[model samples]
Target: MITAVVGMAMAASGCSAPGPDPGGATATSPEPGKSISNAGETASWELLNAAEITPESTVLRLGVTRIECASGITGTVLEPEIQCDGEQIVIRTSVETPEPGDYSCPGNNMVPITVHLQSPVGQRQLFDAACLDAETLATAFCVDGGVRWRP
Candidate 1:
């Protein structure tokens, strides 16, 4: 009985499993001038092509793109900037609130916002924006489709 218990424990522990292969294949970086697309729930944008101009920024060639903001979300892009820190690139911009009472919400709140983009690999990549709510003072970048904020 003891031997049987020990055998069962060993089997459960996967003692006979093979370790990961050190010589396994690795992913290659994306080539320049490749087209990519990024879409969100309410809008989609396309990049005609991409070229990594700097370690901190990748210049995305603009193509025919359309953006549609959902109701209750009101703002205008004043200036958009791409900031890269290490392997991550965040697209941030200053937004100007619409004229007073233009949006259903009260008060004019102009906050600089950022959207995190997936590390540009090649010509093909994607980025997503989390939904926003004004009443709770929630920023974009929702977690699991729920309202969330980070200090």
Candidate 2:
């Protein structure tokens, strides 16, 4: 199958919490499977599956509150990191919130984040690093299709 069915609904209701830290850790770069936010409470976010993929890029659409009670879902401190390990492409995403605003309690307005690649993805598998995170994986945003491509 070439299409990945993304969870279209943003979780909210009894799941709204304060943003972890609009500002994340000062570590220059993020690791492969962790959301290193301000050294406070350990907050993690579930990554949306690839909504669109091309030879040169992968696109994800998610709300600011991503999942249940999940906050600080998007900022821009760091761009979504993309890595190709010969066999699979691993993508790691972090929460870098926007200027404080009312994006809605359960910020459910889907926005897009695109990750570009250096080379066209030929056969390398596509994986959402969020799946590697236990806390993030528990969030509803990630379901089946951890691997975006299947033969």
For each candidate in turn, the TM-score is 0.27, 0.47
Give the number of the best model, judged by TM-score.
2
| Model 2, C-alpha of 5: deviation from truth (Å) | 23
Q: Mind giving the per-residue lDDT tens digits that candidate 1 earns over 1-151?
A: 0000001111222212222212453423222222222222222222333343332332343221112222334344333333222222222223343344423434332222222223322222222221222221143332323211111
Which TM-score value belongs to model 2? 0.47
Which RMSD does model 2 reach against the true structure?
13.8
Model 1 CA deviation exceeding 4 Å by range: 1-75, 105-141, 144-151
In candidate 1, what residue range of length 10 has the lowest lDDT sum? Answer: 1-10
Candidate 2 lowest-lDDT run of ten: 8-17
RMSD of 1: 19.9
* Model 2, residue 52: C-alpha shift (Å): 6.4
Per the 3 Å backbone cut-off, how many clashing residue pairs does candidate 1 have?
Answer: 1
